[model samples]
Target: YRELLLRQRINEAAQAVMVAYAMGGDLDQLAANYNVKRLTVTPADNDAVPPVAAVMESDEALRLRVPAAFEGLSVAGPTAAYEFH
Candidate 1:
């Protein structure tokens, strides 16, 4: 039991260092390091009889965007610069 608990703790710690494999809130935190924020795909509307659910950008999409953001920093106007913005 003690060994299993230690392994679980080690796995949790590894998530912070392994941003590429991170998901959900962990991914969000990692993206913030690159000054990227998750975008909302669908807005929530509570005024309607049935409230609409809000859909956010997926972790996979955000992961791709985060790296692309760095390309925007360059002035050379690479292909990624166009996509980044």
Candidate 2:
């Protein structure tokens, strides 16, 4: 069924996210494991957004904004491949 297939893909995506997260701060490993381009993001040097919100709410991370089903391993915009403080 279409619904079942969709659920399967969602599961895969979630698993991918978990896998990438488990890689710790290693972007190379994340990209190599997921077979996708990897890049890191930080709010602009002068931007006003809180760094925590930037990672927790930005398009890069789906952990907050979208339903668990709709969020894939990656989204349309930047993804936070690493965190620096």
CA-only RMSD, every prediction: 1.4, 13.8
TM-score, prediction 2: 0.25
lDDT of each: 0.87, 0.41
lDDT of 1 by residue, 1-85 (tens): 9999999999987986566888898889888888899999988888977888889999889888988878988899898898899
lDDT of 2 by residue, 1-85 (tens): 9999999888766665553333334433444443443334543344445524222222344222223223344455333321110
Candidate 1: which stretches are off by over 4 Å?
none
Residue 58 of model 2, lDDT score: 29
Write down the lDDT that model 1 would get: 0.87
Q: Which candidate comes out best when scored by TM-score?
A: 1
Q: Model 2: which residue pairs collide?
A: none
